[model samples]
Target: MTSFNTIIIQNIVESLNVGLMVISHEGKIIFLNKAAGAILDLDCEQHLGFGWGELFITDEKSNAQFNQVILDVISQQKVGLKHIASYTLKDSTCPKKLSITSSYLTEDDATLGMVFLFEDITEIFNAEEREKKILSRNAALQKERIEGLDSLSQAVAHQVLNPVTVIGGMANIISRKLPEGDPLIHDVQVISEEALKLEGLVAAVHSYCDIPKPIPVVVSAKALFEEANKSANEILDRIGECIEMKLDCTVDKITVGKKLFHTAIVELLLNASNFTMEKITDVSVKVSRSENIITIKIADHGMGIEKHLLPHVLDPFFSTKAKGVGMGLSRVKKIVFEHQGTLQIESPGSGKGTTVTIELPCPDLSCCSKKNSD
Candidate 1:
């Protein structure tokens, strides 16, 4: 009577939250709790003796897989298996993901039947996917914001630079005429120097935003040297120091933009000058070609970048200088990337100086870069 009277035991399990079912070796369901009946939408009182195929609905492929899994369990092919079933309603609405676990039951070393449990895991999976999409969207928005700021900065810098130049040139003229050791001469010189730094900051803003479409023409090593020297001369005169250009070019007459290439070299020279630790710094420009790639390397004996800060030097608006806008290296990086080239920055420990290298496809081996319509 105790074995046959399972009403009390079944009632206890039926009160629980999770769904549970026990099936015979013939795939016939012997008992199911209230939760299982609700999950499968079955009337446990009327469907207790029904086979799984009659109690549940599924497509042909899934039905076959389900029957095979039950066969494997009965034959002891595996101790347990798990399957996720997605149920679609008549209205085509899908709810939480359902996880079903199937395992065998035994008593006294004899197979009794199989037990199955089900749970919903939809909330957890959907939350994780939503988080990933939010992160991707945030990154895209940040990029757009920075581009907008760059456009605004370029407009403002142009308006400010012209008057700053006039102020600097006037100060230079006054300093040149003043007799040596004049009391006011030193003040004027200081004004001239600060103006020059301001001018550099403005130029950096312009460069950072002004990515040109290159108009390539045949350019020689000597021509590059001259442009760099001329650009650096303004600051050199202000600092009352000089550095020589050490050039070693193996290939001459490489095709590149005359103005843009010169501008990049000059920017490197000015960057070197800004970091000089000595009263005088030595700078060198080296050119070499390997196979179809040409390399231009500029090395300077100046205060080297700190180990930690080197990686961020090319990032827009990231700078060590108190008054700097941090656009110079970013501009150089943009120009190199547009030319299908690579830029590298290398530094020994602080105070040991640094080297900047740029590599581009050799125009002699390849054709000249296509000129932009602009």
Candidate 2:
């Protein structure tokens, strides 16, 4: 009965879908089950006593992460479990994803070898990758459609501007010539004011359509922010509003188009100023860097957007304000996209305030040095 039970256990182990292998402390393969041989495409009987390096390493390369798990189990008595690794086969261009778990093989507290349990997770990994690619492609297509619309709108605005300007000028002239008590004067004044507003909108649309490709230059981030703040202050002064912006920046330098970057900041600052219901709005600007990303966050104590409207903020001609043309954020979005950056707006709810975060890619510092030398 004991012999029959042992045979049953062996059969169960051999038939497991999970691949299993055991290697000695000296890095020699001691056991390779049928599942392991099939997963690794190796003959278990032929590689029983072969070294790990001889069987796995090819062209001085191997699944270093997967092998390290087993090595740690053998050398340091460390157990690694459920670690995923990318493994490229000997002649295959595509890599396979492997889910590996490793533990010690011991008998009566004496360490004999290491046991590795692993399974192919290529299909699962590929599925996740496909989903990511689909999301990315969808975003790209949406951007293309928006940009195409922008191009068409700009052309229409350009064509309408000449006639609008003539209409506005003629109305203004008629208003100036008419008697003060004339009833037609009021009508002409309304026409003139509306035409001027339309002209301004057309100019804005034209500018948005004609944003030049950025010429990136390495500049001090602080300096750029300071310049943008000064410009924003000037605009605020013109509009009879005063703001005190608090800046906290950790990143020293960044590569960006000066005019384009400044425009992006100024647009956000103006938007923040406009939305705040308070007489004096507190705007906080924080710039930080992590790895290869430069993050700039502008937060404002303002009338925050509704939850449903957050996604449409970047859409052209979408606005929450009564008189807003809704082109500011869309223009900023275009600038951010041209710089290969991402923008996110977050707000808890109405009256809670808003935070706009922009992340730009930062290349290596060495590249900056190279460009400076050149």
Candidate 3:
């Protein structure tokens, strides 16, 4: 009756879904389920009499791992061991991943041997590896493209500057020589404006290359904005009282490049002022600071950027205006990141207005001093 019951139990175990193998008290391979035979290319009857050490062959890298697990089982290191191994079988075209769980084949707390359950996870690993390679390839391509753009911009900037200066100089000469209200005076003024726009484009490109060289200093956010506001108003008065200031920061001083950082804020303000050309537009500059980050938000109630174009706003030389240089936001983004900060641009649809938020880390004294000296 006992032998009959044992055979019935073994048959029941062999019919399960997972690959199951049982080792006897002498560490011999006593039983293997049907799933185990299929997974391991096992001739169940031939392999039943061998020890645990004579199981399926793992790859060269996993051979020592297999031995270590066996040693751990023999020494009763813990209640069980679970490991995943990939191995090639006799008739296999590719490696198969097996998630194996080995536990003591015990009854009433007595030492029996080990039982292992394995699952084939070959497809899962292959999918993960494919996704990883795709991401790596994309990152490599992006990096290569950026480096190419940087090189090309540098070469073009020098050539652009000389011609722009000459045109600007000629425009000044023509405007001075022409009489007041002359029809050609307006044309010469347009040429001056266009030349200035070109010069600004060159400067924006140069700012990208020079962002790394800023010597950080302790600067007052209040004073910075005050100066920036005055400068922006002077250069951008045509847009009316479009720029309004709101400061809500208790911490006044932040560490950054006074000149370049001021330049960054001025760029954002100018961008807002330029786009709000219709009537007297409202452009607001708000500053808020927290324990860790300082945020400067610039908002404009003007012609907002299009949704499709918004995503590429910070990209170098990206523009929507017929005569836009496309370096304003790009240079602003570069400067904000150099200060260990982030710049976020948000706009609803076209003609709804745009908001740009810049968040910067609050500077620590020792670190600020170190960076300034360096």
Winning model by TM-score? 2
| lDDT score for candidate 1 against the true structure | 0.76
lDDT of each: 0.76, 0.85, 0.78
What is the per-residue lDDT of model 1 for residues 133-178, given as tens digits with 9 covering 90 to 100?
9976875675577578678988888888998899999999999999
Per-residue CA lDDT of model 2 for 166-226, tens digit only, reads 9999998998899889999999999998998898789888878888889999899999988
Over 4 Å off, model 2: 1-35, 50-119, 176-180, 320-322, 365-374
Show the colliding residue pairs in model 3: 242-283
Query: Which rank order by lDDT, best down to worst?
Result: 2, 3, 1
lDDT of 3 by residue, 1-374 (tens): 57988999877877777898878878788888889888877888888988766664354444455456566666764665787776567755677877778888667988677787878888887898899999779757865775687778888998899999999999999999998889999899999998998899898788676566468998777898878877877776763554665655555577888998898878887787678765444667777665556778888887889989989999888988787778778888767766767889999978899999988876675554544475
